[model samples]
Target: MSKIDQFMSGRLRERKDKLSIRNLSTNILPVDFCSNDYLGFARSGELKHLINTNLASMPDYLNGAGGSRLLSGNTKFTEETEQFIAGFHLAESGLIFNSGYDANVGLLSSVPQRGDTIITDELIHASIIDGCRLSHATRFKFHHNDINDLEDKLKLSKGNIFVVVESVYSMDGDMAPLIAISNICERYQANLIVDEAHATGVFGANGRGLINQLKLTDRVFARIITFGKALGVHGAIVLGSKNLRHYLINFARSFIYTTAAPIHNVAAVRSAYQYLNKIDHQLIHQKIALFRNTLKEQNINAIDSESTIQGILFSSNEAAKLAAAHLQSKGFDVRAILSPTVALGKERLRICLHTFNTDEEIISLVNHLQELN
Candidate 1:
């Protein structure tokens, strides 16, 4: 066989004969057990109207940011968005990025200078790991959420240390110990960077995120908040001090090189924030409670998670795919997170709950899982 064909064959063989891959676009309209639109803002007609209203308020707010932010891409809208997000997040300033993945890559790659030490949780998102790989810092991973392990590592670190973690872990649907991690960072005089991707629009009084809800906004060096998951839009912001913002503008390669996001996309994200800023955050809390309550009642031991992500662990990849397929057939769109995404033997059916989901739908989905179990 040709070299290219041989490479593909090796990948297939490495899948261990347990590759439970599926065909694309199997759009089964089931109860939403797989989307990250936790607050229903993705489908909000009100948010859509707000986008139109804002543009109507400024008819000149045109189509695109044409180039990079430092070049032709920077517009009045960019400054306005930064100011709005800064106020909302209670940061000294906010720097917007094309997306959370870009923000993580840029922040991790740029912030950790040569000779600096970067400590990250073992189960951090792939984007962060990739960014860390690109950084010049000596990198290390602590046991997930184990503060003692983090403290031990920090003690040996010799340079400017940066600790990185996510507020709500996406794959496992667990949380980093923000309070404990913050304490450890403080003890070591290290700057903490928190990625609030999965926490936005689900935590805090106005869904500002876990740090804001806990009143720990002032404790971190930077926070990466995504508009995609909970806010249900496209991009993210790095909330930090004005100096950090300025430094990122000058040094963050990803932000400096890429063309800015389209103005309409930016405005839609702003609209989601505006709508969320006025909604009943307690309602989102109630939905999370209801979903978890039903998951428990049905005896599907969804791993401990208070956020939108919940995992139904399976024995193997095939079992995970089968379980997820069963959920789909029963009118739910749960997804199987397989090996490599998670460890072997820990494959899971990742259930994503949403505020739009009714108690009946949550109950029905869990009951179906119960039958399968």
Candidate 2:
């Protein structure tokens, strides 16, 4: 056989050995217990219609971004969306990116220059780590969500410190100590950036983010919000000062080189925000409350979460796999979150709650998990 075949065969065996091979498939089961469409926006036919309608008005921007924004991609709609997003987050400005992953890599990699110090939470997304790898600054990781630990690290950090963290911990469904973290950043005169990927559409009264919930937006240097999660679309935006906005457009590689996201997608995001502002948001909150109550009733209560994500810790990867399979067997769509996604020995069954999930479905899934362990 060819060397390519030999490589593929060897990799297959390695996956079998480590249980690490990934394959994609669609298994339509019962009510979803495993998607990040927190407010049911992903499946909203109304929002889709809005996108289709508004798209016709922008025929000039159809097809592609044409080229990078620095070339010809930047358009009137891009500016409008950026203005709307920035104002929503109460930032001086906003920079659009293709996805949350891209925004993290683009900004983190470029902003912290050589001889500067960069500190991030241990539980930050892998994209941030990769960005740090490309950065010119020295990288350090503080213990997750512990402001005191972060302060201690910051105290020892060198020139031009930048502290990075998430408004919501994606894996654990818990929040960071934002007020305290901002204070620490303030005391040391360090800049702070918060990733609000999972907190959007579920935290602030206007579904702005956890920072708005805590009234801490102005205190931080930057905040990143993804449209794919609670907003239920694709792409992301970084909220910051106008100088930082201008800087990223001019210097951030991902923004400068990438084909600006299609104009239609940007329009869809604008529609999503419009729907958010007018909808009865409490409906999702009520659904999440029901989900948490069911978890407690089944004695499978999650650890330290106040958001829509409910994680049931299985501790061992094997056990988590078994639990996930059991949920699937019972006709649920939940999946096991294994290591390399989360740290080893902390694997879990991440149950994502949506606004439309029935109370009965929620109870059935939790009771099934409880019965497994």
Task: Give a tens-digit lDDT track for model 2, residues 1-373.
Answer: 9999999999888776766567788677777988999888989999888888888787666687789888888888889899999998888899999999899999998899999999999999888889889999988898988888888888788888899998888888888888988988999999999999999998897799989989897898989999999888999998999999999988889888888888888999999998898678788788878778877777775776888877888777788888888889889999888876888888898888888888888777777877886
State the RMSD for candidate 2: 1.6
lDDT of 1 by residue, 27-116 (tens): 856578788988888888888899889778777765777888888888787689888988888888999999999999999999898899
lDDT of the candidates, in the order given = 0.87, 0.87
Give the total clashing residue pairs for model 1.
0
Residue 187, model 2: Cα distance from true site in angstroms: 0.6
For model 1 the TM-score comes to 0.96
Off by over 4 Å in 1: 20-23
- Which regions of candidate 2 are displaced past 4 Å? 1-12
lDDT score for residue 136 of model 1: 97
- After TM-score superposition, what is the CA distance of residue 167 in candidate 1 from its true location, in Å? 1.0
Angstrom error of the Cα, residue 61, model 2: value is 3.7
